[model samples]
Target: MSKDYLSVMPEDFSDFGLSQPILKAIDQSGYTEPTPIQTQMIPSVMEGRDVIGQAQTGTGKTAAFALPLLNGLRQKKKASPQILVLAPTRELALQVADSFKKYGTYINNLKVLAIYGGEEYSGQLRQLSKGVNIVVGTPGRVMDHIRRGSLKLDTIQSFILDEADEMLKMGFLEDVEWILEQAPQQKQIALFSATMPSSIRRIAATHLHDPVEITIRSKTATASTINQKFLITNGMNAKKEALGRILEVSETDGVLTFVRTKMQTVELAEFLTELGYQAAPLNGDIPQNQRLRTVEQLKSGKIDILVATDVAARGLDVERVSHVINFDIPFDTESYIHRIGRTGRAGRTGEAILLLAPREKSMLKSIERASRRKIEMMHMPSVNEVNKKRIEAYKSRITKTLTEDCSFFDDLIRDYCSETEASVEQVAAALAKLVQGNSPMLLEEKKYERREKRERKQPVGGRNNRRSSGRSDEGMERYRIAVGESHGVKPGNIVGAIANEVDMDSEYIGRISIYDEYSTVDLPAGMPRQLMKVLHNARINGRMMKLSREGEKSSGSERFGNRKNGGKPRRSNPKTSRKPRTASAV
Candidate 1:
């Protein structure tokens, strides 16, 4: 095949020979053109042949397989599943299931059920008992149903392993193989992975019968439709503030913010909500139904932003998503591609903003090489810019109110003005005040109260000065550590260990005061649970240094002193032993 063949995008879905019902469904879906993967793989899948499709996450692989499979399915309820699709995560499973249902909307008697962990199984078992033409699930949950005799694959006509490489990365390859082995030998198997690693290729060779290979290689690394830009982070805690500012100034219809961890997803979402953005969290730990509801909210513009982990946002296809902000930079190139893929989908132009710390700047170069495109350096919207935008929005709202026919409100306004003997402008101003509520129309710039922490002066003294002047200031959180001066631990020990272990800059770490049996260190608040766990188990001076937030008695260090103290005990005892402190907060 010519190189151009791999990049061929069809003008329409009609050439794929889809049934009228499925074609109508596609037209209703607002998709006028077939993506490269769909254009190449649809016909092969319809021919009842095993196919191996290699394409990136947003290349329309779901429809590539789903359309053909739906078209070929006989419109009748069956006792056994006709098609089984194994996705690595619950989000992806639900996504694939939705796709199947959408394409088969016009086809009668087509029941698609999504089964995954973290959800009650009774409903799924009931659905399976009634008969589902298609079953989309994670491997472990699918295996559970299989073992329980609820899902029988003996009559399955086809098996699909979506994101096979992701399954391998998630350590689901074994479960996937076991599920594949259990399927009837007569069934055709189709495997789609972004990258065909040796392990995935081995599985294909073992299970598929002369599989037709289809690869959709994009002509460009990054999608041309997406405007990719990067913003240098102020510090570890500034992502939320920067994101808020960006949203304030940018024309975002809907946003998908990618964080590194599940806990961070919730943290960022809550933070955004506190900042007056309609945001919600999407993660693996959230119940499947709630997650779906959150996605629906984002789709309907009820939620303007969705803070999500990389895994949770997989296969999330929301058309209104106009911006993707990498609140946490992805660790790899492929993840970057998949994350930005959430936007700029189906040929729509979208914006992708990446927040990068100074240390993470190298990853930008790596990603640039991998994507074969330059990520333009972007200056975050200034506080002044945000204020201007907010004021403009307020003015626009007032202007819109003028254009609106307010006969209904006019009576109330006239009555209120007459009763109060007020002027028209006064009534209008009062109404605007009520409409604005507590929301601020302008933002103030607080230099020290930003994402980047200001450099603090190093505490002067030896370990014995631990009780001296190390005190927690406002905006800083104190954490207790089990390893202290009694264990020959110095201030340098705590700073070095935390900075190295947590991948944090020393400048961000605040005051460190070592006590006899424990120590207190001031740090940023709202740390993710994963990082806290890692820090809790951190070892120093050959001792397990248990770290926990100051107020929380998780570490049983409250007896030592108030956690808010920099290092000074609120009430000092001469009998309390201490060592010489060196290298206080850097």
Candidate 2:
């Protein structure tokens, strides 16, 4: 127990003696009490002492250091980057900068800039030249500026390394070390990370001088307020329809749906929009200004749903986001935590629904273990459920309208009934019919069932991989590649190579078998000639994999084919043939 590193248990933000401006901003932001990290670490940071904090995601770590850094800044007329915060990703950089701005709203002439890759240099240069009080940026982009002489570090008083573990994992340790070394030696240092690996500890020991170490271990990665559930589904189209049905039935203020790829985000957003849902796509490709506007629109209720990739949705915090739909199961538990974290923020109740296939049940278990929360199995919303929800909403709308003043509408309705020589009841029924529009109120359960079945049905010889395995279905042609076990060519390798070459999902790929000298992959029929040519020259295991359809004799086969027993016919043994372990689609 070092005297300078005493533990604290503050009841509220006021206990930390934060400046009146910061306290006011916190109150306006609706935060009543400081989170554990903030309560434990803010005091030390504000006292100009070095500190190291270990906290999980969504634990309010940003505010822990941001408030203290802002309070420590002197109210000077001329500013030149007094505090430098290095974040791992662009999203985190921008988010940390936003936190600084929010907490220091009352501080005069306080300028914060977030520098990251993928943006024009002109804007960043302009901001740097104009002078900023604080600069938060990713390590690589920050190094670029430091090298270009655009960013000055001499005026820095406080240096912070946010998400140190993530920066290390992303191979930014060298750049981070370079930046850390460049900063003034006497400056106060604060390092925050979710995990404290030896490498992080080494840096902390070397840089931080008798720093107060505060560790806040969360029982689980996910928030307690989130209602986690999973719906078992199969196939891409079926999952899409199931998502639509879930969106139709759930009473959500706004939804953030997570997918695996940027292309999926755009396609799913487009599909939902076509179905009359107000939806938009958010991904790395979208410009930063547009991304900002899209988020604002989501918060303002202009968009009901957002389809986005994991990279795009990082650091996204919106209060009205009532639901998080994992349209595609996340590849890892960490990503799952981050995806669901979009909701259930600031103690708001949120719904996290995952579209899981039978094969994905194992991943669900992994997530449960990682988050330490059992995800309840949720039944798919049936047609009856959807119709009931719709009818309830319709009735609610009618009740609300009835409660409002409608004297003018009543007279118009009476006049219209008189002109048509119709009874009041008949006129009211006609009006109701007109309001419902061409879309049917009730969906046919059997119709959706039939569609799912039809989509699953394979061509005469085609076999659906989800339901069956082994042997290419009819119409799926077998192609041979010049790499196999001897060349360390695994099923994953072949699947990845073909999928990457053509932008096709691994699930869409058929069966695969590898021979000692060559391998065979089952692909959909009718591959474009140009794509085939491109894949033919594709390199795998440092060898040019020349692909050709089976039964097409190639001169290279007899010329360079591996013959195990001096060209003698090897016995075709079923057990010896390589059947691939299922490859997951990204």
Candidate 3:
């Protein structure tokens, strides 16, 4: 099948018998066709069969399961919940609940409640007392409600475990199993997870009865429509400055910047606004009305930039978003995909730019691999580029006002030129200088270069001095750190920790080899034993280092024991590979 044929189209929603209101909501949300998960799972769900869905985070899985559950609800059904969804995180619960509300808009007399931690429980209790048709909640809170008798699942006809693997990882599998036991034995169960490990499969085997399995894998590892790129920065402040420079240079109609924390969403938005950009923060705390308005502003050009956390920005569709900026590198590869997906949507081409402190280069590589696309290197915009863009913007503004409000500004400019005995060209030049004064654009070239130098100077290896040691072509014994793959260590962490602990240039760090459990990096061939000991004692990822040879042992042996040895080899476990050694002797 052609790539486009395999992908979800907007028209797929038509077959679902969605009421006009729900249809309108979907259309407004920029969904035209159903995703594969939606297409295959929706029908099965509406048929009231338990479903087992395997799809990644960005595959529109929420709507896939939610729409069908809503469709199955009878208009006359009692206020007690007909469906319950258990999610791993509070943010995920809220997101799923919002999806339910949006898709069930036309389902008359339907009520949905989202219950999660860190919120007032009295309001939830009141909602429960009034009765609701659907409840989306985190595992812990749902268990609490069940214990308190505030939540009664006797009438629930459908149950869903979203992000089942995540819940398992968070040690909530016991709670999930307990909750499942509490539900009626006849209830339908739907379990969705990106990756189904043995534990997840067991849950499916025990709960779903001969369930139809649907798996949709993206043919192209990464969204081909997205242009991914990255810029290297020194630290937090330099990253902000570089972001400002990029915003000025990139030709984007609207931009969505992803950050790791809710606090960062606010702080980054504030910084952008202070720089005279139309920017706003979108987070879970923002009222629904305000969030909708912010999204509208972004689409309509009232706001040019949006800073948001991954969860808060879920289900947002703004076709005009031409660029996605990763202000903070995501915690995982899946998040990276979702963040960039905010752009390059609906067959539109978009650009995704990632800002990485010197140490984060390793994570950047992982992101590139996970997305299955090469992320191009983007040089931090130079002072000259910023200045050039500023001049262009200034001229454009002047030209627009001159044409649209000629009478208002033309005479004033003329009067000023005449009174000062200066030519109009000279007057305009002076005005331009005044307008562009003291901005990042006017910063000295040396300042930018110095900042870049500092960024490059930051440490580039792992947290501890567990340098990956290797021999150079000249037979020089080179000692480096194994801060890379072994402990999920990113280049940024390596660089930051090294620079902070030892006065060394991040650039001096040589080639790095990242393995699942450990990484081998090249550094200066010879270093004092005491310095190497200091590095070993240093912590990365909050763990001490015990460095080993890079590529010296087969990664396969480390990961899976040799079958020859009764499947229990004596070598180190790949999953627990320690840090690389700084010196060969060590």
Candidate 4:
């Protein structure tokens, strides 16, 4: 239902029957009205019904559930967790838990805890022992707590699974199912997914009962109000210069710059701050309190620029964000969408600019395909253009000062001009020069290269793709490993572990034969001593291979007892016989 951009949002939150405290919190959150997902899903969830909310990433689903859950906190009072929320990632867990705390600020005796990996257990333990009203965490960590008998779900009134589809994609479906089984039968269940695949549907069928289904799909991954553009930058130097130029010319009110790593966030923020933009770095390592403070600063216009990672910026809904600059492209299209969605939110018009290196053209194509909009190339600002912008800004500042009461500065400048033999304009020019530090007001022109052509002409195969580097065409050598059927080792397992260690392709693997207690395989001759030594400790299915060249007594035919059966045709290498189809099917 949210897909229709023409739909009118709710007039107010009172219509949803939320509590006064929640209303106050929402007011503080600056959400004047509810999004479509919130409008449709809030009332149903408030009534304590099973809900299946299907919505895209930017539909404000977190608040839709968080508000109602907090509103009913008094209905079932318990020191144990009354609400259990499962997210696919720790970052999401942190964000959702923060929201619950924000919405429940006025609700007395309310306590929430976020438990996830990459954290010390002592803090989480202390919070749980002290008593908590809600527990939000990733599935794996939740399972850990359950098995350790630290997290109890018997008193849970509400169980929420956020981003069900993401969990499924990340191979956590089984873990989710197991956790659902642990919840109390009397609890209300809510499952949310962006796209309901068969696995997620099966989960809903198995756990949720008579759920009210809600779906929100936008026409495009990004709002049409967002003007998207890309700049072809060749490397870090060019990309940095391009970023400075773009911000110099573009409308940069509350700009959010996305980078790939935590280190990049700090480095780029420092760079931008040096360039005179008030920028802050945000990443996972920052304390949660500090992170929240940083977010509030950005929201309140205390800072004009925020450089953040995808995880750090997830679920941010700041209306002041006027632009999103992708300093480093995301690994997936979903992340790309989430990154740009920081701007152009709440039906507001915004700009999104992406910097692309030559090697990232394919990723650019993927993003274009996913966003379903043509991202036109950006025009790099010339030296003359930068100078013009600087001049305009300078004149505008001077005009504003003239409008204000600057009598103190005016008298001082007049006295100085009289003492020296200088005109008023010359004195003003000298002050302007002093105000403008050593940093140049304008940037020198930098040339941009079209590296896409070179990228396209590059060949694919390299030494990394080889199964065995420097393996001569003469013949092969037979090797033996002390792992086989008895140890539950399969040919495919052997092939995978060895190939992965050397960054090789599996298709080029040679013949393999497995016995009850051991296995023999033919490999390219003249194996490097270093590679052989590394392979000695290569493990498969938790058992070290202890790999070594056969004692040179066993021939290929003698190793395979079923040679008469002729299991299968060998790899297409000219020097080999039929490769036995023992267990290398994978």
- Write the number of the candidate with greater TM-score, choosing between 1 and 4: 1
Candidate that beats the other on TM-score, 1 or 3, i.e. the better one: 1
After aligning candidate 2 to the native by TM-score, how far in Å is the CA of 101 from where it should be?
1.3
Q: CA lDDT of 419 in candidate 1?
A: 97
Each prediction's Cα lDDT score? 0.80, 0.80, 0.72, 0.76
Q: How far is candidate 3 from the true structure (C-alpha RMSD, Å)?
A: 11.5
Tens digit of per-residue lDDT, candidate 1, span 1-586 = 2112445577899988889999999999999888777777888889898999877877788998999998888655354688999998888898899999999999887889999998898889889999989999999999999999999998799899999978876778889889988989998788998888799989999999988888766623237889999998644455666787888889989999988777788888888899878999998888878988999999888999999888889888899999999987775677788899888877889999998766457678877886778889988687788888888998887789889898988898889888999998988887778887887566657863452345223221112233434555423467888877668888788889998887665655666776767878876545555567778888999877778877566644344443455545434454773444423574
Model 4: residues with Cα > 4 Å off, grouped in runs: 1-33, 74-78, 105-108, 117-123, 168-175, 197-199, 219-222, 285-297, 300-302, 358-369, 372-376, 399-409, 445-586
TM-score of each predicted structure versus truth: 0.75, 0.79, 0.69, 0.69
Model 3 C-alpha lDDT per residue in residues 89-206, reported as the tens digit of each score: 6657777888888888766787999998767789999999998999999899999999999999899899999988778656789999999999999988988887778999998889
Poorly placed runs, candidate 3 (over 4 Å): 1-11, 15-30, 219-222, 234-238, 253-274, 278-321, 345-349, 357-365, 403-409, 412-420, 436-443, 450-459, 462-586
Model 3 lDDT, full chain set: 0.72
After superposition, the stretches of candidate 1 with alpha carbons farther than 4 Å from their true spots are: 1-8, 75-79, 219-222, 405-440, 445-586
Candidate 4 backbone collisions, by pair: 570-579
Q: After superposition, how far is residue 221 of candidate 1 from its true place, in Å?
A: 6.9
Each candidate: how many clashes?
A: 5, 1, 27, 1
